[model samples]
Target: MYTYSDFDRAFINARNAQFRAQVERRIDGSLTEDEFRPLRLMNGLYLQLHAYMLRVAIPYGTLSSDQMRGLAFIAEKFDKGYGHFTTRQNIQYNWPKLKDVPDILDELAKVQLHAIQTSGNTIRNVTADHFAGASADELEDPRPYAELIRQWSTDHPEFQFLGRKFKIAVSGSPTDRAVTKAHDIGLRMVKNDAGDVGFEVIVGGGLGRTPMEGKVIREFLPKGDLLPYLESVVAVYNLLGRRDNKYKARIKITVHENGLDKYRELVEAEFPHRRAAFNGIDQELLDQIRPQFKSPYFTTAPKAEFEKAYAKDPVFRSFVDTNTATHRNDDYAIVTISIKKHGATPGDATAEQMRVMADLAEEFGHNELRISHEQNVVLPHVHKAHLPAIFARLQQADLATANVGLASDIIACPGMDYCALATARSIPVAQELAERFDALKLEHEVGELKIKISGCINACGHHHVGHIGILGLDRAGVENYQVTLGGDGSENFAIGERAGPGFSYAEIVPAIERVIKAYLEEREDDAETFIETYRRVGMAPFKAALYPDADKGRKHAA
Candidate 1:
């Protein structure tokens, strides 16, 4: 994790002080609601349907145990007992008294955390692979680069007021766990012909009312040129991006309206000026940041206890099999604590749960914790010998669900339960789905499935890339859900195709059940995942399953 320097701390303190005065002005009636809207938004405060929501940035999703404790404190003291972890690797408190927000910001600043750049049209919190440094397959740690981007983008004069919000994701691993394809700018670390590591710069990919996968503007950009190139790209977008319409103002739309070739040409034209402006200052700063992310001292202790538990304890074995991931160090494993337990809110962790996670991270994870884009907490470096003890602690805290990539482990936003923009309730739908799947006992049999739910067309839940995407909408004063099949958020990213008509809220769960059953029937074998089956047979079979009576109705009409 990149520790905030003296200068960084000073900047945050000043910003917090400034926002504190602004909050007072609004409360005292000196500033009207209309006047306070922008001011509040700049500080990551939003006036939701019921109450104020504060989004705190977890830069590159990294957190220390102390920081986690701070979040727990905030959840307990200011808002409700729980905090909602978002798909962007950030946390949002859905219920905060407007008067208490300034206090919350002050509390966050104590732990070196802040809500800056979490909202507004400015570049949002820079996200990266959750298993950045610990992943065995990654060529390098992406967090260092992510930190550099964070330092550069925070309150950058030019980008602070873009036409629309922009998101950037960095992935050092070839596997693309970061979902780089769906970001405003996706930086995938790659090797050039000369065998030097660089980035495959992808631009204009986003999911909302208009979802589109990013296109590769640069096949390979040198490592040193990252800042300048990114500057050029954003600069180009700032100049050409639409402003008249808020809906079509994102860089994705700008790139879509203007051809990729033309965009590339403009970016290329701007690159030289950006390059000259940097003058190697970025590279010098990167060198300083690199050492902070060096691998933690790993233990080479024997895994006899872990082996014994894996063999003797079926429950522990199941948890291990379901939740643990391979780490770069052979002696260690990356443990993803599933915040999404069956029948619960998808990405919510109670204050107590947060504290437990913090304690576990301090004890077994070298005091380093991560918030994954999938809305889960990650212990990126847990020794294999400590797995049993860690699992025991998690079990005590009700965090041991043993479902990581399984069907019951769904990614859902706070939906209508909290979000003002939500048309229908995403929490209830997600909860019902998880409970339904758990009762059927088919999660293990079903295997890896990405089921994402969004409350509206905003795509905050990232439904477009889910293996089975459920998008909730308002239809004739009733809640309805539209299902999209074959959407994926990996390196081979694809937008899911909608399957026929929407399902009423009452019928949506059963409708999803039908789709899964169809997959089981059509799959070549058990090893073939839902995505594989969908790819092999296409949506015709799933569509048939979803709307069984449609064919008969068509025939009768004919």
Candidate 2:
């Protein structure tokens, strides 16, 4: 984990003081809601359905054990007993009081965490692969670069008020666990034929009303030129990006309207000018930042104990099988703590549970914790021998769910319940689906199914990438839900296809059941998972089961 320097400490302290005064003004009626809106948003405070929600940034999804404990403290002291981890790897407290937010931020600043850039049209938190430094397939750790980008974009003069919120994700591994292609900007770390590191820059990718896979703006940009190159891209977008309509304000729209070739030409023309202006300053800064992220030391311990635990404890074995990943080091493993317990709210962790995780990270694992893009927390470096003890501790805290890549592990957004932009509820739907599947114990039987839910067309829940995706919509003042199938979240990502007609809130769960049952019946064997079966058989059978009346209507229309 990266520690905050004196500079970071001073900056956060000053910002907190400013926000404290602003909050006092708002409470005293010196500032009305209209006047306080931007100020509150800049501080990552939002007025939600019932209360204010505070989103705190976990930079590149990485945190220290002490920071985790601080978050736990905030959750317990101020809001409800639990917090919701978002898809962007930030955590949101749904019930924060308007007046207490500054105090909460003050506590967060003590641990080098803050809510800056967690919301608004400014550059949002820069995300990277959760298993960045530890992943066996990684060419380099992407966090230092992500942190560099964060520093450059935070309160940037040129990009403070972009047309819309901008999201950027970086992945060092070829597997693309960060869902880079689904972001506004995706940077894939690559090694050239000469073995020099660089980035394959992809732009225009986003998921909202208009979902798009990013276009490759530059096939290969040397690592040294990354900052300058990124600056040029943003500058081009800032100058040319649509501002006339909110719907057309994103850079994706700019790329779509002007065409990729023309957009590339414009960006290329601007690059040289920006490159000359920076004059290798960004590279020098990166060189300085790189050493701060050097790999942690590992002990040469024997794995015989881990092997014995795997053989003896079925529960521990299951967790080890599903939740742990290979580390770059021999005796260490990356342990994923599953937030998706069956019948529990996906990504919701109680304060006590957070403390337990923090303790475990500090004790058995390195003091480093990671938040996955799937909204799960990870202990990035746990020795294999500590598996049994760690599992026991996590079980005590109710954090020992064995479903990692399974059906019950759904990714959902805080929909109508917490988000003002939402047209319908998403979290409840995800909960219902989890409960229904757990009752049937069909998760393991169905195998590796991803079900993502979004409240509206914004697709924050990533409904576009699920193997079985559900979208909540509003129809005639009633909440309705739609289903999409065969979506993938991998390197070979594809947006799902819609099943004919939408269903009411009550009908949606059964619709999902129908789709799953149909898959089990039509699949070649148990070996074929839902996604594979859906891909091989297409959406015909699932659609037929979901919308038989629609099929009949189509026939009648013909």
Candidate 3:
């Protein structure tokens, strides 16, 4: 974990003070809802369906044990007893009072966390691979670069108000765990033939009503020139991106309308000028920032104990099998604490659970925690020898659910339950589906399936990339959910295909089960995962299972 510098501390304190005054003005009736909207949004406060939701940024998804403890305190003190972790690697409090938000921001500032760019049409939180520092396949940790970008983009004069919210993701590993293709800007760390580090820059990618896979703007940009190149890309989009219509305001629309070649030409033309302006500042800053992220000292611990624990304890064995990832260090493992427990609210972590995680991170891990895009908490650098003890602690906290990358590990947004923009419920749907799968014990058989649910077309849940995507919609005063299949959130990312017509709230869970059952029956073997089966067999069988009558009618019509 990178400690916040004095400069960082001062900046957050100042911002919190400013927001505090704004909150006072709003309460005092000097500011109407229209006048207060931007101010509140800038502070990461949203007036959602039932109450105000406060989204706190966990920069690059990194958190210290102290920070985690602070969040637990906030969750306990204000709003509900639990918090929802979002796909953007941020956390949301569902029932924050309007007046208490500034106070909350003040408290967050104490822990070097704030919610400034968590919302609004400005550049949002810069996300990176959750396992950046720990992943075995990583060329370099992406968090330093992400932190550099975060500093540059925060309250940036040029980019404070974009046409729409801009999102950027970076991945240090060959495997794209960060879902780079679905971001406004995606940077993948790559090494050249000469073994020099650089970024593979991709632009114009996004999801919403119009989902687009980002196109490679630059195949190889030297690590030193990252900021300048990124500056050029965002500058080009800022100038050329649509302002006339909000729907057509995204950079993806700019790329789509102008064509990739022309867009590339414009960006390339702007690059030299932008590069000169930055004048090695990015490299200089990165040189300074790199030291802050020095690898934690580790003892040459034996892995025999870990193997013994795995052999002896079934729960520990399952935890190691499902939750742990290979670390760059031979004796260490990256353990993900699944927040998506069966029948619980997706991404909701209780205050006590957060404290337990903090304690675990401090004791067994390297005092480091990461929040994943899949809504899981990660202890990034845990010694393999500590696996049993850590698993025991997590199990007691109800955090040891061995369903990482499985069907039960659902990604869901705060739909009508919390989000004012949502027309239907998302959390309940995700919860029910998880419970259904657990009851049937079908998750293990399903094998590495992503089931993302969004309240609406905004795609906050990243439903577009799920193996079995569910979109909740409001139709005629009823909550209806539409299913999509064949989607993947991986290195080989593909948007899901719609299975059939929407299902009613009462029918959606059964419909999902039917689709899964169809996949099981139609699959070549149990070895084939849901995605593999969907890819091989396509959506026809799943579609038929969900809407047999509709398929038959279409056949009759044909």
The predicted structure with the larger TM-score, 2 or 3, is 3
In candidate 3, what are the lDDT values of residues 281-339, reduced to their tens digit?
77888888999898999867778878988888887887788998999988888999998
Report the poorest 10 consecutive residues by lDDT, candidate 1. 411-420
- Candidate-wise lDDT, in order: 0.94, 0.89, 0.89
Tens digit of per-residue lDDT, candidate 2, span 1-558: 566778888989999999999999999999999999999899899888888899999989998889999999999999889999999999999998887888999999988899998988888999999999999999989998998998889889999899999999999998899988888889999888998888999999988899888889998898877888898888888888988898899989988999989988988888888889988778777777788898877877778988998999887898998898999886889999999887677788999999999999898877889999898999989899888889988888888988888888899988998888999998888888888998888877888888999999999999999998889999999998989898887788888888777889989999899888999999999899888898899978988889877889999999
Please state the error at residue 122 of candidate 3 in Å: 1.0
Stretches of candidate 3 exceeding 4 Å from the true structure: 551-558
lDDT of 1 by residue, 1-558 (tens): 788899999999999999999999998999999999998899899988899999999999999999999999999999889999999999999999988999999999999999998999999999999999999999889899999999999999999899999999999988988899899999999998899999999999999999999999999999899999999999999999999999999999999999999999999999999999999999999999999998899878989999999999999999999998999888999999999899989999999999999999999999999999999999999999999999999999999998899998899988898888999889999999999999999999999999999999999999999999999999988998999999999998999999989999999999999999999999999999999999999999999889989977988999
How far out, in Å, is residue 520 in model 2? 2.3
In model 2, the worst 10-residue window by lDDT is 1-10
Give the runs in model 1 whose Cα sits over 4 Å from its true position. Answer: 555-558
How good is model 2 by TM-score?
0.97
Q: Which candidate is the best by TM-score?
A: 1
- Model 2 residue 528 distance off true place after TM-score fit, in angstroms: 3.0
Candidate 2: residue 428 Cα off by (Å): 1.7
Clashes of each: 0, 0, 0
